[model samples]
Target chain A: MKKVLNLILFLGFTFWCFAQDHVNSENRIANRHCLDCHGQRVYSFVNPDDGSTVRKLMPVDFRVDSALFYTGAHHIFKCVDCHVPEYDSFPHPNQLRFEPMYACLDCHGGDDTYAKYHFETIDEQFQKSVHSPETLNGFTCWNCHDPHSFRINQRTGESIANTIAYDNAVCMKCHFETGSEVMLLLANEKLKPMSVSHDWLPNQELHFRQVRCIECHAAMHDSLLVAHLVSPADSAVKQCKECHSRNTMLLSSWYRFQNIENRNKNGFVNGVLLNEAYVIGASRNEILNILSLILFGLTLGGILVHALFRLKMNKRKRHE
Target chain B: MSEKLYLYPLWLRLWHGLNALFFLTLLVTGISMQYSDIDFPLVRFDLAVTGHNIAGIGITLSYFMFITGNLFTSNGRQYRINIRSLFSDLLAQGRYYLFGIFSKQIPPFPVTLKSKFNPLQRVSYIGAMYVLFPIVAITGWALLFPETIARQAFGYSGTLLTALLHIVMGFFMSIFMIVHVYMCTVGKTPLSNFKSMINGYHEAH
Candidate 1:
């Protein structure tokens, strides 16, 4: 009886594994079918009324870059997973266009697999940010983070410059005119050019290249990977010491990944930053400072003793 | 009676005075910047930066003047080291300062018309002006225009190493200045050497 039971359980497990693979394969095919029309800039169709060919340009918002989609966090998902099943139909019903969009929490909330991401906490942070739904009429996570192409670059151990560029581009999408038609459609007012707004900053170009826009604009949070609470322009940090001092915010924000990677490495004062550019006052070594102070003190003491001896000798010579 | 020699000319005196002013300005401003604290600042941060930059430029120009003066004038001859007797010359001069001066014995190497510096003075001056000064000046300029510094060097940030090198050189130069000033008093009288720099003459025994 025991032997029969074991055989049945083994077959049952094997069938379940095969079923899972089949489902995944089918989902991938479905995703490809959707991408066939969405990936291209234009698609041709037959206008049945006139029996003529019609070339229709896909709206920018409706289009998706296949390469980016495949690499994104949602690559494993099928087109109908987050989207309505009606989208799977040919000529997707016009009502599907107005279908309520899914927020990040719609799928991630209360899910054990996404618990580590602290998506709930991030949602709370976003609610308090300047870009919150309450503050802006139609603002959502999709405005800054495109669901089609968004990837985690900071923790991927890429160069800080690459990470800065990727993250800053998200803000510049709406803040500056990068010629994206979708941005113009989403924007309520004329975008304030970054160059014009940041004119008062010294070494503006260098600052932009070296750091992310969020470093000053966002409030830092120890629990979150990146700060979501965006501050208003008047509240932004302008003091040089905020970044130049030993307790710089960069250590916690921009350089956090590098810092964690190099925390155990030896032979550097500010080892994290020592691997990249050095910030004055911030990069100072405690050991070096103490050693220099000791040396200076010794030299001064030696000079004082020598001067005293010389004074005594001069007096003796006068007596003679 | 003492024999007088024209060791410092009018131009040399003027340069020496300007160099002293610049060095003092740099030292004060540099300390303020290196150990800057918002609560207890040595000098206002902005002012210190401005002062340091101006002094740095002044010192850089002064260094060029020193190089040109040494190249074109007889003063250049004093810096040339006699490699053959260098060790012996240094020992004798060192001995005089350490023991002989206390006993009122004659100096091992006296200031002469042709030789302005004793062997000990010659070596230290060369190390300061030739080696340390050039390094500090170059690194200062590199810091001012950080784009010139290599992004990385020897598996470390080049800017950090350059900054460390600059600080070390500046520290040594400060020590050298202190010693140089004190040594001036070891002449015929405590004020005699200072007077000569002022009046362009050295009184030799």
Candidate 2:
């Protein structure tokens, strides 16, 4: 009985040690993510022209936490795989701007990185798009998804899954209502093309679908830095291109602002600074024409009859 | 003694009366078609459609009759568009009604057997004959079957676009009807023009 008891005690001790080791192994990379704000010294390199190039010393830096490496499918990637230039000094990016943003092919471009199979044609098309080279809000897979905190446990409220749920709210911020409706006059034929081309969204979709208007079209701006903004706050203005692709007379946001200033000096100005009416007024007039026709029957029926009667009696005399 | 000369011929009278009747049918049936919400035993869709089609056929056929009659008649010269004469004739007619008629003076443009229509009547009649009515007919025909066109052209066929086009054209016609009614008040008497149409005669009193 004493020998059996001793055996049990030894097995229990071993089990406890194994459990302790597993807990310690779980925390491979503890805490890492991008910093919300760069410190004052980081802004010390702003030229105000290009709005690029910055130097060290920020309170926060946006980072990919090492703790996530073990949990996510990205456990396949190394620390330097995404932040290419900062591979050596990952836990602390020694150089400030060396952490390049969203280069898809750099790690995956070659023979080994699945570029040979999964994304060969798509990558080519993506590179050719207006969104290429950082024009389109630099849309990367990261823009739509958060890799590590993709799914959450319902009961515990813990985000642990790897499948990324899409976040469209990220786009809604820029495209809320930048369009100047131009002066749509009910139903003018001249304004038909402009009005017909525009897809007016229903009120319900604004709340539920939350689809940004500019997702497909080009963003309204001269450049990224000095982009003249109607409302720097709402997403509707710039994000219309998200789906629309067509804003002719292609004045950038900066030029429109310039145009607004010229108009203001001439003693005429709209608050939003574009009169969509000029573009669509002809179409409104066309609708009015149709209205005129409807009223024609009411007002002219008697006159037509009088003329017809005169014509009829003349014909009768000729027959006689 | 007043001029009791006959101004209209037999064929013209027949054509005019039939045209007037067709217009009435069209007006009644067209209104019913627009406001389908109103229920009447006589105003079913098939009945309205039959009336409308007959009217449409009458209007189209009469269009030819009027054109040929206008071309062959000696009174055709009265319909010539002399821009200088047109402006003066319009003013003379306007003044006679506004100042002369209220003053009970003799009318400015007298009705003659040789020139049945005054300048104002001539131009408006021409527009109705040439431009306005044709638009309604062509657009109406197209709107009646938009799917056939859309199917042949776009490959996807549906009534949505056709219905929208029909409604739009219908609205224009309604607007024209309102303006047409107001102008009838401008005649020799409020019902003078009305009487003339029904009787095929205008006594230059």
Candidate 3:
């Protein structure tokens, strides 16, 4: 009896250890340690170009919504992992800009790392993007995705709805409403209105909710990677055939954010990815459709010829 | 004068009407979803999805009703083809439609108590209901619950194959609908067969 009890106890202990390894809990307190000040109204700065004084609450000014941070990609990371020594001290010096504004390439730079998560191409693509060649001041990854807010392996387990909302929020942060840092930044540059009106797209809001704005605005290619280069408004994918054709971008966009293993050599974006929900033209099989159309045409022709023959036979019988 | 017979009983008529309604709705919604990006979609893409799902449920239920009704009634007997002469009879019927009918040759076989459907009709209906209909329905439901499909042995790629099969079968079913409607007009009077369907009576000439 004692031996059996020991075996059961050993099994129970092993199970507990396995469970602990699988469940990764976010260290929210570590974030709060920094937010305790950043959350309060303590920072202000005068814009050199616009002559406007920018003073606001720490979390709000920096666009750090704590609630969002808790559920974000970096939730599992400690604040110290990305921060510099200057940020560790209290009452940070006035001259200190955001210390350790880590660029995406710091870790995800080399070809090996980029092959895993192809953000390197995004940098190359951005140069030719619609915002290119003439932004009053240039921008980088941090302009759109703040390193603190951005998380690695972002879409591994996220819901499609949540993923879409998060993607659009990144773009709309500057483009939708005024008074946003992004808007202010764009305005300061003296660039054209970053805000766009996509009246032509059917069910515009639903499309916005279903897919990222970058999906259409970016350059077209075999891979789902959004070319960081924003296309000019006129160059946007205006022709429906671009997506409705046999090769559709909508079919592959969802595959881009997933693990690299999902892709294969046979030109399938998400190799054998079975979507529960259909995306209109995206689900159509061109070969099968063409074959069915040919069948329909032949059947129609046969019927018409048969009808004419019958008509001729009946007319002759009447004459007889 | 034509011989009047009460061939389509109440249950058969109900099943036929319900099947027609469901199939038409499924086709419209399915086509709309397939071609939504083309231009001026028949219905909004989201609404098309909603309608297709509802119609799919209706089809599933009606399909069950059809099978059950056939089992319980004499109507099921109409679909049973005699294997001994099936091939020859099918050929004869093919000739009747293509050459004999235009030449004013009389029909080889007429509707009787034991055989309501001629060889061609029987083979087509059996293949459609038993083979094609089930393939389309099973695949459609599989698509609706993709998580279940992913869990199965076939996994993700299997789900794509299922969707492809469903779409191809759906195309055939549409063609069947067109031919079936046209055949309805092939009776002595164009409206004769249509009236018989409504009143549960078929006239034998």
Candidate 4:
């Protein structure tokens, strides 16, 4: 009986090891196969009519950096998992190129594991955004976010400036210059350059460096970690007081993470001050303000008393 | 009888008037910016900022005139203090303001030709012009060009510290303006000192 048990245990252990090896081998093969074509700086092909070799540089959108992909959020996903299975065949059929792309919700939605992320709420917000499929044709989750390399940045303990740069870069990918080929492909029009559109802003460069475009452009949602409902340009926030008042919207949005981490423990009114931001009118101490007002009041009261006494004294001197 | 002395030069009078105008502008605009509310704004937000900046520049230029005038003229001598008699002089002046003035007692250290200011006036003027003004001016310029300010100092935001200092100095300056105006009423006539500032003269009774 002991000998039989040992044999069964040995067989089970071997099968487990073999399965692990096979899974790893498949991943390696898939990665190598996809990256082989997508990773090249330039793609070369024979022109069928002329029998001449033509070299063309790969577009930024089509090229994949292997290093980034292996470390990306969707690193575990095989190419066939997201792409058409028929893409496994060499010289994939031209019809596969037109296959409908997968939205983030296609895999992440309705899953118990991803429930905490509120994918449904995100979808709801996105549907109302300017980039919604009904509002802007061909716009998708992949337009702003590249699944090949998108990473969760704000919650990664990175500096606010780094997070701002990363997030703004995603917006600038489509919104930067007027006549770039990429802009034509994505926006399908000669979009106004960012510099011209934002010329009315004071300290525009500093603002761009320190803040994300979505801070002003997106419709704020209380439950959303980052607002997704991108408002139209005409509806964007233009008032300086929006971020410069005591009840600044920034504390609820761009500065939210920092405000939570570095909340003032010394009874400071504005928590954003501790994070090295001294917004005028917004970053005032309540204690100091009250003390100042009290002092001013006392001084005024003292002056009035002094004046009354002097007037009384002068009257008595005249009577005498 | 009252005698008139040319205590203020034309340039000094001009500087003084411009300084008062600019300071008032700064006071109103600065308060508006610091305590801005959307519904009940003291001044419109953008207008306050523009007005404050213009007034700030005006004050800066006025300060420069004051410094240059004092440096090249005998007016500078008025700020000098005799450290040995400082405490006693301050006490005398403090007592005069607190009690003697109301009781019709004669001023102990009256204004004179060689001594333009009383001991208390000298010390307070020195504190305001030499110490507080320089600090406020430097910090104001630093704020105007924020890139020059340090990102952090002593574990506090450097810009916050600068702004707080500016506000404190500005508060003290406001208090000084109030007391200074009231002190002018204590002259031979209530309007006599104001006339002296206008006509570059001082009246001693």
Candidate number with greatest lDDT: 4
Q: Indicate the DockQ of the complex predicted as candidate 3.
A: 0.21
> Which pairs of residues have clashing backbones in candidate 4?
none
CA shift of B201, model 2, Å: 4.2
- What local distance difference test score does each model get? 0.81, 0.46, 0.70, 0.82
Cα lDDT tens digits, model 1, A1-320, are 99999999999999999887674566668888788788879977777789898888988878988788877777778877778888877767988778898899998898999886778888988999888888777889898888888888855776666787888888877776434554455545565567777776765777886778888998988777678989888899887667766667777764765766655554345564365646665566778789988988998898899889988988888898
- Chain A (candidate 4) TM-score to true chain A: 0.75
Clashing residue pairs, backbone N/CA/C < 3 A, model 1: none
Candidate achieving higher DockQ, 3 or 4: 4
lDDT of 3 by residue, B37-127 (tens): 5456676666677788999999999999999988998888888889999899999999899888877787877777778788999988998
Better of 3 and 4 by TM-score: 4
The sequence of per-residue lDDT tens digits that candidate 4 reaches over residues A1-320 is 99999999999999989986674566657777777767777877677789898888877777988777766677777777888888776567999979988888998899999876678888999999988888777778898889988877755666566788889999888788564665576567777888899988876876887678998999877666678999999999898777767777777874765667566443335454556666777777777889999988998888889888888988998899
In model 3, the runs with Cα more than 4 Å from the true position are: A1-101, A105-264, A267-278, B151-156
Report how far residue B54 has shifted in candidate 2, in Å.
2.3
The worst-scoring run of ten residues by lDDT in candidate 3 chain A lies at A258-267
The model with the greatest TM-score is 4
Higher-lDDT candidate among 1 and 2?
A: 1
Question: Which tens-of-lDDT digit does each residue in B1-205 have in candidate 4?
Answer: 6788999999999999999999899889888888877666788777888888888899889999999999999998889999999999999989998899878898998788789899988988888888888887788888877778876788677788899889889888888888788878878778899999999888985
* DockQ list for all candidates: 0.34, 0.03, 0.21, 0.39
Candidate 2 to truth, TM: 0.36
User: Which portions of model 2 show Cα errors greater than 4 Å?
Assistant: A1-320, B38-42, B144-201
Candidate number with greatest DockQ: 4
Q: List chain A TM-scores, every candidate, in order.
A: 0.80, 0.31, 0.67, 0.75
Residue A26 lDDT in candidate 2: 39
